[model samples]
Target: MLDDETPVLDNHLHLDPDNHRGIDAVRDFARLGGTHLLVVNKPSWHLGVEAETGEDFRAVFERTIEIVDEASSELDGRAWPVLGVHPGLITRLVDDRGFSPDEARDLMQAGIDVAAEYVESGEALALKSGRPHYEVDDDVWAASNAVMRRAFERGAELDCAVQLHAEASEDMTEVTDWAEEAGLPSDRVVKHYASGRLEGPIPSVMSEKDRLETAAERGEPFLMETDYIDDPDRPGAVLGPKTVPRRVRWLLENGRDEAVRIAHVETPERVYGIDTEATLERA
Candidate 1:
């Protein structure tokens, strides 16, 4: 029997149309024991380098909304959706349009406004790909922060949480500072991909043990994620159906369990927004 007090939340997951297992596969995963699954919507055009375009960007956002609408009713509160303009796409949009920094910021803000409505309806707002472009020095960084600020202001009113993808320790710190400045509760903000940096050409890695240890020392409660199985064909990407239990075991072995929270299993309740009663029945 499962312990009543054991906590499990799949802090990161991708449920786009391209998922090999399809939505039903994710649903089955959640039925096992996933408490919460944070789902992200990515633009189809941005899925690969070839399909990227301004029209495709908008199409992706629209499709993401459609997907959420379909899944949310079935999943209920079990699935939390985070909507945002990915940094990589933002860079591409800027480069493609030849827009000045100010123009780019305005465009991104517009995207956030549209995304906020979805969040206001109970979906969480997630700012994915924070490091590659939204750093202090980059022009897009300020724009990205502005987008976050808008979402934060709206989310605060609704008691919603905003999820952020942190690529580097510095990026994590920057995001934390921004959240603090906005007077947003730290607990309301969840950072994704907390595992230590992995050695490779890919941008994201498991966060270093020391980094997580330090966060724990400071009494910060952040979410830890293992975004395993990046498509080698598509560089700079991460897909789902994570090795949850195995990753959790690794953390326990390293004595990092107390430093982070792990969701060992993902069920439909967590991944697809299924109803609790239904989730329990499935479990």
Candidate 2:
């Protein structure tokens, strides 16, 4: 309570055992006023460019659920899992394993289906799927878009929100179009790491202070993310989740209560479905 009175919800975090950032990172985040965390289970790594078996992916997801419980118990903050098939794996499979385009797409769908199953069973809250390492190759675009569309479709079928980790150039209009085609509303698809292109139809998480000011000026409501890599070597590769609350508190200190209320409280509760009152007991 010493940090800030306003309860904060971090919509994206990584407490993966594989990353192994250690519990101190979670404690540090809580100590700094992070109340709730959406712990996105890391997908396969781009470093080891190997094809992943469906069983291997499922095991990783199951471990993700376990880590969510562990983080919530060990840290004062509430933790939830965002399950998905990271698109980079598809690229690796095609590029390293010599998987044909169809094989890669099919493998991605299998992983997505598993994630959808977890969502339906209440093992995870939302979906996190994105196409990364995109290039001018029309085949890559075709495959990536198809994978993202399928992710949206799965989310729609399960009535869960979908968060994308796609290209920075991908705008809300394009995402909304895909979501509509997949039978989901625009607001349910959150464009993570959103920058530059603001004022989109869907909700997104931003980090820049000036852009945050711009969003406030336009009366645009969105969430904030640090993309917290939890890597000691990278040392806040994206940022530490604590950064969001610091920014929000600065705004609150400066008479930006309305903006803070909308972004931190209302928007997170509405979009990420977190109960702010029940979290960050350690903070």
- Work out the TM-score per prediction: 0.65, 0.89
lDDT (tens digit, per residue) of candidate 2 on 1-283: 3354576666777764655564666767677666667778776562132435554567768877887887777555577889888877766777767987778888887788888888999989998887774573667667777888898899889878888887765355877788878887777788787762454434455666875676566556677777787665676577776787677777778777787777767776676666665554543
Q: Please give the distance, in angstroms, between residue 282's alpha carbon in candidate 1 and its true position after superposition.
A: 5.0
Superposition error at 240 for model 2 (Å): 1.9
Give the worst 10-residue stretch by lDDT in candidate 1.
Answer: 196-205
For all candidates in order, the CA lDDT equals 0.48, 0.71
- The Cα error of candidate 1 at residue 100, in Å, is 2.2
Can you give the lDDT of residue 219 in candidate 2? 59
Q: Considering every candidate listed, which one attains the maximal lDDT?
A: 2
State model 1's lDDT.
0.48
Give the residue spans of candidate 1 off by over 4 A.
1-7, 18-20, 24-28, 31-35, 47-62, 65-77, 123-138, 170-174, 196-220, 228-232, 235-240, 249-282
Query: Which lDDT value does model 2 have at 236?
Result: 54
- Which residue pairs show collisions in model 2? none
- lDDT per residue for candidate 1 within 1-283, as digits (tens), equals 2223334445566655554433653554344433444567654344542233233344555565555555444432355566765555456556775766567566655665556666666544443334342444566666656666665565455555565554444335555556556665544555555543322111122434454454445433344444532233453355344334334445556765564342223222232223334333222
